[model samples]
Target: MNFLNVDIPVKNVPELDKGFVPLGLFFKNYQKGAAKPLCIAVERSGGQIGTYETKIYGTPEMEQADAYYVDRLVKFLLWSWGGFKVSICGDDNVAAAIRAAYSEGGSRAFDKGFMEQVYETEFIVESLPYDKKPEAVQRAESIGRHLDGGRIGFDAGGSDRKVSAVLDGEPIYSEEVVWFPKTISNPDYHFEGIMAALSTAAAKILEKGGHVDAIGVSSAGVYIDNKCMVASLFLKVGKDEFDKKVKNIYTRAAEQLSSQLGYHIPVVVANDGDVSALAGAMGLGENGIMGIAMGTSEAVGYVDTEGNICGWLNELAFAPVDGQPDAMEDEWSGDIGCGVKYFSQDGVIKLAPRAGIELTGASPAEKLKEVQALMAADDARAKAVYESIGVYLGHTLGLYAMFYDIRHVQMMGRVMSGKGGDIIMETASRVMDEEYPDVAFRPEAPDEKTRRVGQSAAAASLPELK
Candidate 1:
């Protein structure tokens, strides 16, 4: 793999310093009978230019998959560089392959509407002409004064929802209530449950003579323009009701709560992964952080170098991580070798039986609990489960590095809860040091208090709060 740095001129570009960076991503399969790698050229304001190239090698089908992966990597890079308005330049074949992959709806489907949402630009099959009209750039919502006065932060998880009453970046009150979001088919159940939780938090603020100014939400699934495009929370609802009622559930719930409270507050909802990344960034006081939560599923969020969350679909759970022909299959997507199978609690449960440990529990969660108990007692079989996960982490981190200039990865979720978490991080670090020494990055896990505070505080900061 060869990486060359070159300066390329972009024509008729608006001044980037006006809050948006312009980037051109080029993909070429063969150049002079040799496979040309994925190339990205970025131009910021003040006459600055940077180019990045990474080699690609595989058969036609594999290379096509690589293109999809490269597309995701380019999005991450451009986001980290700063807010970007990107132009994708590639030949007819590259463009068609990407379009087909996204259309097929599998591991390659995550980037389906990515270009339209994040970059506000389209993919050009032919060579990009020097002069093209740039689309009107929309600046991200400002977080200014959102975190100040009083705020309610909520994080909706698989089994429980967490609510926090925050005053100027500090939580005055917080609580967790268990709710059945997945199995409930009625949208009213979800609506009532969510509003009740927020009401509890709002009451705390009012008790202290503080008025609720805004509500920030972090939830699992895809959110576009503050609406739930696809989420597990509404999976059981009928298609018609899911589309009509459950789509904007959060915003609607907020409005109802606002009416009851006799004041209208701005409401902001974002992907949980992005909130986790934002939390990690806030906790560390740094940028370029990718936060991966390995709980019921693998959730990912990234904070770019400019300390802004890129609105890209960081749905890395379904993103392909292993290219081997016989990788483990995701039961949900039936795709081979996805990130979810290796990063979530499901990953550990799947590996339990393989390690020759027979779990007598009835469910996967119960089986996971048994494994954690074994690890607590220093059982070798339980230890091996995490060690293998460490190995997975090392390899996946290498793969992730190809796409993200990740400086720090904050590992959260149930899988990283106990002694098992320590072993996983230790072994992964050793693997990276011994096997992938060239990769310059480190992984860290936050303490319990820090994790909770960071999560709620970051949730409060989502509307771009100062």
Candidate 2:
């Protein structure tokens, strides 16, 4: 398939999404041209800066393509690495377009607003000369793996809430409670539910003759200092009530529980992505790992070569994947060809009808269950859906290689459940071997059964009690 000037020898293509072009393959072929220098830098909290300096096509005929290419790169960098101020050095036209798009009433208003809320700062776009460009901080701080004393680990999800009462490194009690947090608008529902979960876990810890030392929360969304900046669990909540109550709900719940327990219990809330990475790292005893969970959406995090988790957003759900101009659009971010549309249960639901499977489930998760049932029946159509995702992953890893120094890739979530997941991992490995010979997803996928901690339970190691 020819995308722009480059031709990609893609073997396994999605039947429905035939126009799919892997961004990694496309970029790899593009950079082999008369690429010019361009630097994209982003500054986040604590003035931490992350820079991606690369070559862009400088040919006069490729002006429009240059803009599209640069824009996607910046978008990927922002969501994956994260930043409030985007500094574009050595490109004026591309910078101008970004400034206009990120403006108050532009195409990327949603992304800009989300960043502002996350970093709690006004977002800015600046175009600078290469000489005046920022340098890479690449700050990967040591986090998680405290695993001491009495702790309550809570994982907040859109469908259910999971809490584990962990004493030392082992969990004394664990439970999963189903609730509809995404549909509820009242902050009290959230407050009461969180309190109930914490209270239940506390009772179990007390039964084990332990007292709450720390409360650690593993959750989705961008968190700044254990505060809810933006989360899907609070999607229905209004800004007024979110600020008034939901902002500090986790800590407040911990505080109230502490008041009852008669002890000062500090709570550390880390993004589930980071916790997943930490879990995978601990499980494998390796670093330079990137964790990707295909659940309701695509969640990702990285553990750098130094065995440290970076402070970046690692929100790959919104990061672009397919280079197809008319690729599938994500409902939340309203972005096309993103990971959420290709790597999550939504990807399965999108492919089901095309693969001749009629799904009648009301929710995305339930629809995924239907597909898994078909896969278990050795349905060829179900296999086709997973093969397409495998093709998507095999190519996207090349794109990810452009940024991260990856040694091992850890996969998780409901989308990766059952035999279908095996199809994805196996097919992806084959694609890597055939197409990206050098891009290695080494040591194979880690065994989930032997994992040190479940994705949510990993939060028990987040806080180091004082």
Candidate 3:
């Protein structure tokens, strides 16, 4: 796997400094031959060059003429400046394209070093694929299956904070939950349990002839770069040892599983919410979108451009409100994060106590069921509570819209759907219209197809597999 660094050289100091243009990336990989890059970075300036950014959705192979036209345009721009210059970091194809674009019949003119190329030992930025969307997805899926046993994910809860190995969008393997027993005294208990749990999942995957791709942990916290846990919210694991310990446990489990399965594969350790987002973002269904999971705490998520789960997508808990600047932190903190304090199950409980509801008589889940019953009965009090909760939910969702730069927000967990879903959705739409008339917010129900596809894509990203 080689990388290409195509530098679009320009003279303007200001434009270059600002990284004005959003360069498009395209590349091709071969099975039996060397991989080559079909690269181009077209920069437009406000002064001499007109400022314009257009997109070509198809690939270089599918849209050969379009790619060629782009190549020619880049060459012309380069020559118009002084000479066409490109830094080739992959195969000879990068150099060849420049030569062809600047040749005698080519559009650009060059005196001497028009096609001169050099091999520099520096980090280069190669573009990601922009063509053959279906094919690219298929390739990614294949890679996922190859790397892991169709699983790559994370999970977290009260005493169950662990990464997972998912396949076909299901948790086939998981890291052990760290139980924080009130009467317990041993420090190693949590770590030992987690290791054992991870090993158990690994053993199960290997038994099925499925490989291990990546490990994703979902807990009550924030994770970044799939490497470190920012705030483990309610988890007992410290921020310091999360990276090292999780990796070590996953590595040992993968090795053990591979030995048992007669093969070796790579593993990734990540946060659970991100994995849930990956499951949702890969189009799990009609609502195949923004994943908001609330258990001990709440987390909002979406898949990023890198095909990885991202918990930092919205962080609506930290969002600032207009009339109440500190409402986000003051109102939406502690047990609920953003969802509960305003919209989730705990929010319902909070409302319950205020409305003389008997929430103490039943289990939390059962109590939630009762809330849904109240909503179904069309009780005026329950209706009002649900509607208000819906508004709060929508407000958070609106934040998701602005942050992700996307519109559709999928509502997950027990609190957002079923008997209360319609009320919540209606309120979300209404509030979105009131707060942000310019944006469109459509809520969707979950489905199997999107989940399967997302899982497939995530699974395809597993590395170090045969």
Candidate 4:
């Protein structure tokens, strides 16, 4: 459950081309009525531990007695390599019994051999399961049977909590749990909420005797390999801890869920847009295809040639775009992001003033509709706005192609709704064709079923796992 903090020295040896040091030895008896002793050695500072099993015979026979002598030899060698000072060897009851019998008996059977007390220290070790699976699943399923199928729900924009259980391909159970909230001081507030939702969902699945295949999370941030948190619209929970927490929860969730379901399986954690990409890519018959969801934000993910996940990736806002002098795409590009900045809701807001079109609410979809009607009358500003959105999307996709060798790009979300999507797709296609003459760029829309499946699949692929 917890790791020990130990200080150990590092040394280099020149003569024998090796380093030598002393180490502490601890022994434990795991099996009942055992004649031989199962032992383990731990460095004094506890940085490492080595385990070995040995059997000592009653008769001091050269061949058989020395046959099991490898144990002591191995421990000594390992301790020496670690640069520890071995003063005396300290062991538990079983180790003591074996040592005493060997010492007092002395001949072949009586002489179990020599075990010098290399170090004397009061340290202890205990036995624990490597992990618990299958059983946890059974327990979770038992709980599920008694429930009314309510699942825990989370508000993407707020903290409204509810429970809901939907059984599509797999049983997804969501629940509410306590979590530390993020504030202005912690800009990743929504990201924290996403993690909390995942944790509660994991717990619920475990409680209901169900196996969790993967968890897809929708957040206002970015995802990288090893589950690294690149940036967030809300919080600043450094990438180090973000990766650590996500991995830890993933392992715990998989083990517990598997145990409840009575099966051992791996679980994946992924960003929502990445999941969206995966689901969208399923329909595309290409080796490497990516899906980009351009909305209030942008999320990108790809499916490899074999259908394994690449990753749910983002943080392209900071990516540089061509033909933009002295400008970072996120800040200086005509839009906030080349593609998302121009095509998303934010893009809509910025373009309204230039086109002399005013939207009553902050909805990009509503604003776009208003802009479309104005443009239908051949308004130059309105048409330019939509055209620019398409051109930016095309340019961004062209850049992505260079990095991933991607073939088809599936577009989704409000950005892909109606006429704007068509224009964007046309622009993106033109850019891809111009840049990579040999490659093909196809665009398509994603349906609901594929979206759900893709989301879960992408989530299941989250990485930096133990």
RMSD of each: 9.6, 1.7, 17.8, 23.1
lDDT of 2 at 316: 89
Task: Give the higher-lDDT candidate: 2 or 4.
Answer: 2
Candidate 4 local lDDT, 1-466, one digit each (tens)? 0001112222211111122111110111111122543333323222333233333322343223233233333323332222122211223333443334334342211111111211223222232222311111100000001112222222232123222333333436544444433333343443445545555665666576654443333333333322323334334454455545532433454465456557554433344544455555543434465767666555565555555443223434323332222222344222212334544666655656755566775555577677666666666666666665655565455445534556567787565666666665775566545543455665566656565444433333332123
TM-score of 1: 0.78
TM-score of 3: 0.53
**Model with the higher lDDT, candidate 1 or 4:** 1
* Model 1 lDDT tens row, 1-466: 1112212222211111111111121122222233544444443322233345544433564465456445544444443442223333333345455445545363444343433333344422222322331333323333212457788888888899888899887789988888989999989998988899888989999999988888889998777667886787777999789878888999998899889988778788888888888777676767788888898888888877677664556777876654444667787656666688878988888788878888899877788899999999999889988987876776677667766668889999889989999988887787677645788886789646557666655676666433
On residues 70-133, what C-alpha lDDT tens digit does candidate 3 reach at each position?
Answer: 4433433332221123332222443455556445554233222222211111212233232411
User: If scored against the real structure, what TM-score would every candidate get?
Assistant: 0.78, 0.96, 0.53, 0.48
Ranking by lDDT: 2, 1, 3, 4
**Considering summed lDDT, which 10 consecutive residues are worst modelled in model 2?**
442-451
- Candidate 3 runs further than 4 Å off: 1-154, 159-187, 209-220, 224-234, 237-265, 284-289, 304-314, 325-340, 356-358, 361-370, 450-466
Query: How many residue pairs clash (N, CA or C atoms closer than 3 angstroms) in each of the candidate models, in the order given?
Result: 3, 0, 27, 54
Q: Which one wins by TM-score: 1 or 3?
A: 1
- Model 2: pairs clashing at backbone N, Cα or C within 3 Å: none
Model 2: lDDT equals: 0.84
lDDT of 3: 0.43
> lDDT of candidate 4?
0.41
- Candidate closest to the true structure, highest lDDT: 2
Candidate 2 per-residue lDDT, tens place, 145-237, comes to: 788898888988878998889998898888899999999999999889888989999999898898888888988888888998889889999
